[model samples]
Target: MDRISQLPDELLLRILSLLPTSKDVVDTMVLSKRWKFLWMFVPRLLYDDSHQDIDYGRFSRFVDRSLILYKAPALETLHFKLGKICGAGDLHVWIRAADKFSVRELIIEIDSSSRASPAILPRSLYTESSMLVTLKLNNAILLDVSSSVSFPSLKTLRLVSVTYPGNEFVNSLLSNCHALQDLVVDQCPDDNVTILTVKVASLKSLALHTSDDRVEDFAHGFMIDAPNLECFHLRDGTGGFCVIENDMPNIVDAYIDVSYALPRTILSCITSVQHLDLCLLTTEVFFLLQLRVVVLTIAYENISVSVRLLILQDAYPVSSIFPCLVRLKICTCETEWLNLLMRVLKDSHKLQALELGRHHNRGGNVYWSEPSSVPECVSGNLETLEWLDYEGREEEKQVASYFLRFGSCLKKVTIKPESTSYDRDKLVMIKELSFLPRSSPACQISFD
Candidate 1:
């Protein structure tokens, strides 16, 4: 380790760069005299209150002292987490100094409760042609930038809880940041409808999350022409509306959450996706049937029997809904709903693993009626079964019996019953069922 520290200054700085926060790097200064000055040469300076015991004012002073001591012309990265009550003028000065240093990666997070001032970034910081590779701002304001505010070296940009003047403000910012490859916007609101047009052909990743409470009347659309785009995440927290127009052949992962009224049209765009996570009320089951997913996780809340039947009716008829699904996790109550699920699982010939759980509420004497007195053979390829929140009752025994008879290919069974006193009778029942023999497969059952 001593020999490692004796390496060149560039190598030493590289080693220090692995620390997530500046305080962690500072604590290492006490290790030895040789390490005292090493942190000063490190290109990344990250200041987060959550990682240190200093307030905003003290942190600002630390940054000033560090800059004066290092006297470096540029920084590779600069991260600051100023609480909700930061001084506007102090923030402006910090950005101005960062601009002079040509900071490559900048992350500035203001407290969520702080009201943003209209003027935050100095005009010089935006106008200067710097080599900023990544920029992330939260709960801040974007001032007017000159047409010369072109970031030729920028690759990633993220804005969350930020305020913009109008749609034109956002459009101009995106148009100027021409070299951006990744874009993320969360809880950002504009005065008018925003139409985000992406001309950056190198863009590969995009994440958009809107507020569910504030509905914006914007007919939003993306004109993405990037052939190399791979990952996309779109969530409507505010229940806003958006339209996507792109044929991404390289996209491998996608997540879509929207109101029941707007689920189908948005998902119809991504026909070649492989992995998907869906959370919807029962009405959106039609859209769930279209995806060719290998892993499917579905969450339903306060769903009624009529809606549940609709899902079973569609899922059982066409195995193509989850034809490639090998792992399935269903979050529902241990009530009659299991009958509907059993019907669905009987059709999933390719399923290998199953996870069943009851909701946190509705916990006692939960009953699950089998689809038939003679258990229907289910997922003959299933090898593992997990029952979550199992409150060992007669209902649980019935469930175990159904699995014992129908799960011919099962090899492992896990019963995670509620953490309570175990009944001796239920324990004996589980033990006897574990030893049952069949020509299909030997199943192992355990409880926690």
Candidate 2:
């Protein structure tokens, strides 16, 4: 017999609770008679049916038996994923059973191959369960709650593909969750929620992602007023106007990813952020649209209205606007990114590190534009420069040469050439770049 089997039942049950799934915990029952009923007392239960080999009939039978036979006084966590086979009514019964046991953390993932209808969440979830500290629902429906919603101890809430009656229900649900700290809403596809206002005073971290496939004609957006928020992430799918009423003076970091144009209001909200990341679709890369001041025209019959726009139309004088910015990273393959780089270097006087690369997307070429004057950072605070998937094009070489020549306080410049380039070509580019005059005698140029 193994020494582990000799441990007390309490210790054995604690050991089993750390496993990834309750199914794994049950499998240990066959180890010995002492282990047979130990899993029944485990505080955490997790069921996942995403695997292709999962036997639906057997899994259902197992869940039904587990809930009935479970003897734990209180469940620390209860998680289950009901795929296409399980009905919403059955899931409601499961939630009620878990509620009887006083579960503290509950995660239900409803993934149905059928898009015809989404599973409806039980009403008891909002009105009766006060012990819940964490709640996550995916691909589920939340019916309108006319009663006062309650979850006194709840701190984290994540809803993905969850449909509610309308935006008011969502607002009411969040407003009542007084102790919430982390909230995530991802890709909810109901037309009833055209405009959403999230006003959580206690929220500290928030993430919101919308679908990129939204129709252009739809009126959809969000308004936020979280005063004490520290971190925020927004992955916008299209052009939607987002308004932030309260200034987030306590914000430390922010990540913004958009498929199309970002609203003007967003940039102003993150002025105090020390770290910032901007990700966008290749078609929406700023400099590609910056090559010329293009006049976008709309015509009806013989009449045309011409609208002149800048690359950063609503956001100009980037440095003065972001006075607190310290570190900046740009992930783009657009050749015109250098133009934006110059503007940032001129404005962000406190910037310490700069990173440039193709982020999550393939690389192409870097376009070179003559800078009218040397950027402030090139002569002062800039320390490190790193570039990934560098193609060593002529424009890239010129830009590298300019930075190497003018960066008086620069310490390191690291470049990684794209895999398509020949080893000999990389060496030639390295030697040529290495010979350029460096303003900072200690500045080192390394190539990969």
Of the candidates shown, which would achieve the greatest TM-score relative to the real structure?
A: 2
lDDT by residue (1-448, candidate 1, tens digit) is 7898789988888888888888787777888888887787788888775333457677778767766666557788888876535666766666766777888888887765443442254455566536788989877766665464577788899988777656666766776777888988775555243444455567788887765545533233333445556777776533223444456666656665443334444444444455444333232333443231111112333222333332233322333234444665554532334544554465445667777765335443445756643323253577888887765566767777777677778888887765564577557656766665533557777776
Residue range 298-321, candidate 2, lDDT tens digits: 221211121223233543333346
Name the 10 consecutive residues with the lowest summed lDDT in model 1.
Answer: 290-299
Off by more than 4 A, model 1: 1-15, 18-36, 49-58, 71-74, 84-89, 96-102, 113-119, 123-126, 146-149, 175-179, 188-201, 212-228, 284-448
**Overall lDDT per candidate, in order of appearance:** 0.60, 0.74
Clashing pairs in 2: 319-347, 335-367
List of clashing residue pairs for candidate 1? 211-237, 211-238, 212-237, 212-238
